[model samples]
Target: MPKVSSVIVPYAVYLRVYEPLAAFPEPERTHWARYARRPDLPSYQDELRRSLAGLLPTPPVAAPVQESGDAFVTEVDGVLCVCPWRTRLRGWLALAELDEELPRPVLEAALPEVVRLQAAQDHERWLESNPDARPWIRMAVWQVPLHWFVLVSDEERAYEKGTGEVAPVLRYRTPMVQARRRVARSLRTLKDSMDEGPLVEGLLDVGRWLEEFHPRSLVELDYGGLVHVLPAGDLEDDHSARDVAEGIEALRTGDGAAAGEAYARLVERWRSVRDRRSAN
Candidate 1:
């Protein structure tokens, strides 16, 4: 099958994801090299080629990481690359899913030292390079070879420890949409939320476009609905799963605007709720 690689990183790396993502039209490739590492940038071009061989067999000239990161002056395949800002140290090790032939020790051994090095100091400062010469956001990236450098992050345990939250919103690529919808529908089968049902519906409405929208934000809103406002055992309680087979059907009718509106509404509602809480 496909040989998959993983990058487990600290929550800080997740925060940086949005910054780099905003710069590109499509974030197919990741990372723009910084000046400090310009001479070595060309080497990574091969890594990119190797990484994308299976996924995208036909390759073109190296594309920018996102478009506007503070990573100017880099080398891709020995060609010079320029990033707006320095990279960052973030990310932590977690689970990895890969092909049967993939090496385990290579992946594991790489992350610990990478995380440790990144933890020690902010080696490369990450930024979403803008005209103002200031970053919309900035963080450090922790590099560990053998890991395809998807998420540059730090440790998870320390993050939660400092934040003092039970389950932090994992700053990682997540496929939480259908899973959370299933959970919401299951709860609805028994007893649903009066106010929060709409939020769940909004998420359901997004459909495929949900990926275009940040799943991380959607996950955040859902967590708030379930944990903060929704009742006890609302999500975790055992019950007959609600057959959202009807709503699922509606989503397939080619309603991109409706789907977009629903997703946007959920985000707005979340913002409103979050704002109110902050004010209190």
Candidate 2:
């Protein structure tokens, strides 16, 4: 095998399941995010590195050849990405030299048991800083070449006692919201008869996002959730909501499946928003 020297990576760590922040993109995050944890290319950089440190009576993981605050330039073959309200996230850990697609379940075999053992150390540190009723560490492992993402959330005793939307993570995501609107609009035009391709493509995007997502982000995944489309709901929802209302204006004007589907999507899109608000 060829000797590997260096690579680049990015990563995230989330704590709560379906936490609202899980929906927003990282760059737009509010300034308040910094108080919780350390972030680097493959998140929990120290934990991951300490776990994988090559050899010593008690050695450090291979030092990053170079690193910045969010991305670490190293030779490790793994990466992590941060996800919202703390449920899901993704990051990159570049693996040098060994280039074939990684096998499934390689993480358990590759990372040492001590990494798992060190969990409490960070937990104590996090608790000391914020002292939330509960503290958790969710690690998302991603191996890009293999198309893999695995989640690990080490939650604390206090949180496990609770259930049902305890807290919400505020999100400010422009790109994801734009993509949601685009897809919803295309879906609204399904009856145009001009072509089915665009609408079909929109459905495809919806399916992909739905499948990979947890239930929380799905709530306000859009602009206050889905397109308004007139009498159905508020006008501020977005263009697609207005479009849906217009489409219905041209509908056979009945609550048949097509109308129902459109209306249902409007509701579904806004569900994340509604649910969170209800919880609050």
State every prediction's TM-score relative to the real structure. Answer: 0.21, 0.23
lDDT of each: 0.29, 0.32
The clash numbers for all candidates, in the given order, read 32, 36
Best by TM-score: 2
List runs of model 1 lying over 4 Å from the truth: 1-67, 70-159, 163-197, 211-280
* Model number with the top lDDT: 2
Residues forming the 10-long window of minimal summed lDDT in candidate 2:
143-152
For model 2, the stretches where C-alpha displacement exceeds 4 angstroms are 1-194, 219-240, 252-280
lDDT of 1 at 93: 12
Task: Compute the lDDT of residue 225 as modeled in candidate 1.
Answer: 15
Candidate 1, 1-280: lDDT as tens digits: 1213232222122122122233434332344322244343322223223323322322211222233233323233344323232222112111112223237576444334444344333322332233223222222122111111111112211211112333332122222353345444533531332344543454443333233333332111112112333223322331111112322223455554554554454445445444544554
